[model samples]
Target: MKVLHVITGLGIGGAEQQLRLLLRHLPVRSSVVTLTNPGAVAAGIEADGTPVTHLGMTGNRDLGALPRLARFVRQGRYDLVHTHLYRACVYGRTAARLAGVRRVIATEHSLGETQIEGRPLSAGTRALYLASERLGTSTVAVSPSVARRLAEWGVPPERIRIVPNGIETDRFAFDAGARRRTRQALGLPEDAHVVGGVGRLTPGKRFDRLVRAVASIPDARLLLVGEGEHRAELLRVAGECGAADRVLLAGACEDPPAAASAGPALPELLAAMDVFVSTSPDETFGLAVVEALAAGLPVLYVACPAVDDLAPEAAPGARRIGESVPELISALRGIRDARLARLPLPAAARRYDIARSAEQLMTLYDQAVHGTPLPAK
Candidate 1:
């Protein structure tokens, strides 16, 4: 089937990279449209042979974007329209309907309890979201927690489908050669205990707490991947905690399958780490924790619906810790003292495989187009 994906931006975020990965595996003709910045992920998608169009949407209030997007949808004559992220869902749904496309699917990638995509969820936001949601055929939640959240927000339970975000599991498999090279490239001591976290460097992620926790451990070093507004604040927090030198902000790294970029790829960085931690108390899906588990690293997370919702045995290497610096310190100490070796890849990793997710999504797409009944959760 011919599918067109609309998204807010093609940046180096989970949803964007997930789209790129999905495009590679999905057995359908697909194209992409970004409502704003077409960044690194856009390049990667194009490199993978998918056409990408930037809508040049100036801001949330850009009414002109509606007609422009609608025109593109009409011209493409897409069999289905799949939207990702908030702005794209709203505009893409409207545009698809305007273009006479009835089967529109929206995947809510970053909706949290109090926020949607790291921004506070005001009444206006919810109103717009619910209103636009009515235009779509189905809304795919990245996790069960997200499905529940959508229901609480008044979305019809029948319209929500749980298609967990997936990863190319083997790409993240731990490599001993990569570990040595990455550590040496980053100037990390071979014996140093590296504690890593990957996500947007936002306050909600509580990366400051991670910096402080690593600072308390004399021999532990913190490696933060991904970039955001909180970089300066995190550095300041590191200085205050006397761990300024120990904290290394590795900026953003693209997915491993993407074309080689300047920085170290995610799997390489994962190889360099001893353990992984996710301090965010609010997470729709803890993708980084899953990636760490795929790398066979023991994971310490304050909240991860992806792991918590699954059977414990699914992620044997992941441990849910408390949401405080002291608790983080204790967990890190426990890991250090135990001298835990790299873990075996977890069942959870295989469960969320990109190939599996693509197949699930393709089924949804087929059902949506053929007016077939959706399978029960």
Candidate 2:
């Protein structure tokens, strides 16, 4: 089937990377359209043989862009239109309907209490989201926690489908050679204890807390991967914590597949570290934590609904820590080599394999198009 994916911006984030990975596995013809900046992720998607269109949507007030998007949808004659992120979902749903596309799917990737996209959710925003959501055939929630949040936001429970995010299990599998090579390439000391985190360097991610926690551990070094506007502030916070030299930032991964490369990619960056950390209190799904688990690293996180909701037997490497500086410092100090080495490798792979998720999604797509009853969840 011919499918068109509409997304807010093709940037290197969890949702965008997930879309790229899905395209690699999907057996249908797919194209991408970004409502705003078509950044590095766009390049990666194009590299994978998919065409990406950039709609120069200047601002939220750009009403003219709506007709332009609808025109493209009509001209492309797409069999299905799938949208991702808040802005893209709202506008893409409306445009798809205007173009007379009957089968439209939108994925709610990041929705949390008190915030939608790093901003306080206002009444006007909710109204807009609800109004636009009504135009879609169905909504896909990245996690069960996200489905509950969507129900709380007035989306009918029947309209929501739970499709947990998937990770490339084989890509993140631990390698002794990778560890040695990545550490050497990134200039990490062979014997130093490393604490790593991955995500956009934003205020909401609570990276400042990580800096403070790193300062409390004498021998621990911090490595954060991802790019954002908060880099300067993070640097300042690291300086204030007196751990500037101990903290290393590798910006963002352009092509997520490269993350597993033996070079300076995210998976390699993850390999160079001894432990994984997540300070974000509001996470719809903790993709990074799962990737760390795939890599056999012990994880310490706070309020990660994705990891928390998993069966205890599925992810033994994850530990939920209290939300405090002292607690973080204690967790960092408590991580031992034996504990990290004993992570549940086989169970994690079985739980989060991308192939399984891709197959499930293709089934959902067929059900949406043919108006068939959903299989038992």
Candidate 3:
């Protein structure tokens, strides 16, 4: 089937990386369309042999862009149009319907409560979101928590499907050689007690909390990875926490796989770390946490709906915390080597393999194609 994926812009985030893997591995004719000019994400998609489009949009609500997209979808006669993020879902679904495409699917990757990055929306933007939900046939939530949030936003529960983002667990499996090679390449001390985190420098990520927590741990160094607008602020926070020298800001690495841009690769980085730390307030699904488990690295996560649900049986290395700074400092100090080593990360990660997640998505896509009802949210 000729399938089209519409993403706002394939920035190196968890949802974008998951889509990258799915498009590369799925045995289907797929192309990716980006609303804005493509960057590293597009380059990675191109490397995988999937076609990429930069719709040349200057802003979110480009008027002419809509007809242009509608015409393209009409001409391609696409079997399915699946979208990621808010902008693409809004405009992509609207255009797909205007083009008379049979199916349009949208996946909610981030909880809307925290997804807003800039100015609060004006009235028109809110109206557009409401309209987009009506046009899309099926809505997929990255986690059950997201599904619950989507329902609160007026999406009928029956129209939503829960398909937690999948990871290629094999990519995360413990590799002692990789640990040695990566550390050697980066010039880290052989005995460094590494603490690592992966995410854009965003307020919701609570990276500042991590910096504070790191200050409470002895002989610990931190690796903060990924690129975003908040990089400067994060650096400032590190200084505020007196952790400047103890932190290594990789900015962002230009890894060809681009998988290194997020998710399992971050866990691979965790393989070299003694502990993994995430301070994100309310994660839909702790993809990086699972990746850490897969790499046999213990983690300390701020309690949220998704983190609370991550079965300890799967992540024996995971510890949940309420919103307390003292609690975080204590958690960091309490991570003993034996306890961290006991977490069955590989076994835990095996259950979240992308192959299984893809099959479930494919089933949902098949049903969407025939205008069939989605599972109850």
Best by TM-score: 1
lDDT of 3 by residue, 1-377 (tens): 78999988876777777788777667779988988858777888888899998888779657888998898888888999998887888889989999998588888886545453233535566567768888987789877787877787778887888877777776666777778766776666867888888777777678777877786676678887777787888778778877778877666533236543433245446667778888877677777777767777777887444445566565666778755667877877777444455345545577677787787788788787765554553
Instruction: Report how far off residue 361 is in candidate 1 (Å).
Output: 0.1
Tell me the lDDT of model 1 at 335: 96
lDDT tens string, model 2, 203-265? 899888898999878878998998899899989988998899999887887546533344476
User: Ten consecutive residues with minimal summed lDDT in candidate 1?
Assistant: 255-264
Poorly placed runs, candidate 1 (over 4 Å): none
Q: CA lDDT, every prediction?
A: 0.93, 0.85, 0.74
TM-score for all models, in order of appearance: 0.98, 0.96, 0.90
Q: Which of 1 and 3 is ahead in lDDT?
A: 1
Query: Residue 332 error for model 1, in Å?
Result: 0.9
- Model 3 regions more than 4 Å off: 112-126, 253-268, 303-306, 336-339, 346-348, 370-377
Best by lDDT: 1
